[model samples]
Target: MVRGKIQMKFIENESSRLVTFSKRKNGLLKKARELSVLCDAEVALIIFSQKGRLFQFSSSNMENTIEKYLEHGKEEETTTNNTEVQQHVQPLKHEGAFTAKKIEFFESSKRKLLGQDLGTCSVEELHDIHIQLENSLKTIRARKAELYKEDIKKSKAKEKFLFQENTRLRKQCGRKPNQTPEKQKEIASCSQRTVSLEVVTDLFIGLPPFQ
Candidate 1:
């Protein structure tokens, strides 16, 4: 008799599930090691079990592999951003321009902004460009001021909230607060009394003195 192929579904029984996990985990690690040895490749494998038990393997140090992966990802991101350079300018007065004309306009404007190919620009065009730059600078400054004000407002609100919370917590815990009129009032109104816990017998049955 030949063994049947196992179905591709989760094992329901706990014992069977654990056995399968152990076998597969070892097999996967063995394969990773074999591939790294056979191909001289840098390989990193990480596994987390249902219980959060971690297993990892790396051709080299795991930390070094992680650093290399991060560096490579960063370099790839930079390259992708560098490849997606687009030159956009404000739309021309004639919105019905052809695609080629729009592209030409954008390229020309980009060059002008970069201070290149300015020989063909007339005095009026140069003046217009100067006005646009001045307006752009004004807009940028306005936005920066708005952001600064918003950030400062948020910081002030946060500081006020934290101080209030600290005061409330201190009062709740009956702890002395920083020197202030309220702290002085609290200290002044407070009084301490010694508590006597002695017990006296009140079961005396003897006759009292005759009146």
Candidate 2:
């Protein structure tokens, strides 16, 4: 292991700095590859040369390594935030179960606000998340609506082509095919029920009482 505390001042000699950077870059890459192969770890390195060009390396996929780094950082941040919360709430530890749980809930929210460990969130925290989801969905839906007009026009053109074909087929057969009223009603009812249930569940999950 190359371990030392190096001075922070800039190396004024351009040749020396360039040589040092080249040597250290090779050493860093060697260490990264060895760690990845030996421990089954992923590594990503991003360096900018003195000339401002980018140099990058990855043991696996660069995107995967970067995402893993972000996720690991979030987990570390969540743990650190939770520790801070614990210290703040330590005086409430002697309180009853209900109060202790409320403290836990707030602490968990703090973690979520910090974007850490959102996977372990409770039902109440999930409700809070659902609210954020709804706001995001609203923005998405607005953009989708703008795109949907063009989609509708394309669908209508396809429908017209299909209708012309159907007309030609009906003229040849001298008969029209129809869906039975009972089957149509059943399909309509099922679709309505599915939509209603989805809406109800979304509302139920994000209710303020749970929060």
Candidate 3:
């Protein structure tokens, strides 16, 4: 019995998809090994399932074959026709490029999850990472802004209370015994310093120490 050509698209049925994947994967690996042996060529293959399963093969030591393949690839310019054969023999080489990117993404994420990113990343990678950080920073900044506003409101309230208290104290100072002009000045200076510290701490609230 003969089967008609299957359409090139995602298989909707899980059982059929698995069966096709298994059959094609086996055939692809078989062809790869045969080519390597008969033609005395090096080969490596790598496949990742949509479910993230990995399958791989090599003719010789995988590393040596991969290195040799890369060196040879540099010497030859492969077009579309040759590309099909090249991909068949060394699918890993193609997949490796994408895998490298995926590895970088995961490594970057791992660093962030572990609190070790520390703002060190390449420009392009940093760009994507920046979005995530910017969103986090936005939240922090909003919260910080809210806190600052609240703090400022409290400070204004305190200032109004102090102003009224000072007015009362000044009225009393003239009448009260043993209160001096120098002590009033010192109290005012201490309050000013406290306000300055609050402002400085508020400025530092959402910023990283290094940046």
My TM-score estimates for the predictions, one after another, are 0.39, 0.38, 0.33
lDDT of 2 by residue, 155-183 (tens): 87886677677767877898774444456
> How do the candidates rank by lDDT, highest first?
1, 2, 3
Candidate with the greatest TM-score versus the true structure: 1
Pairs of colliding residues, candidate 1: none
Candidate models: Cα lDDT each: 0.84, 0.82, 0.82
**Prediction RMSDs, each to the true structure:** 34.9, 31.3, 27.3
Off by over 4 Å in 2: 1-9, 93-211
Provide the lDDT at 178 for model 1: 53
The runs of at least 3 residues in candidate 3 whose Cα sits more than 4 Å from the true structure, single-residue gaps closed, are: 72-211
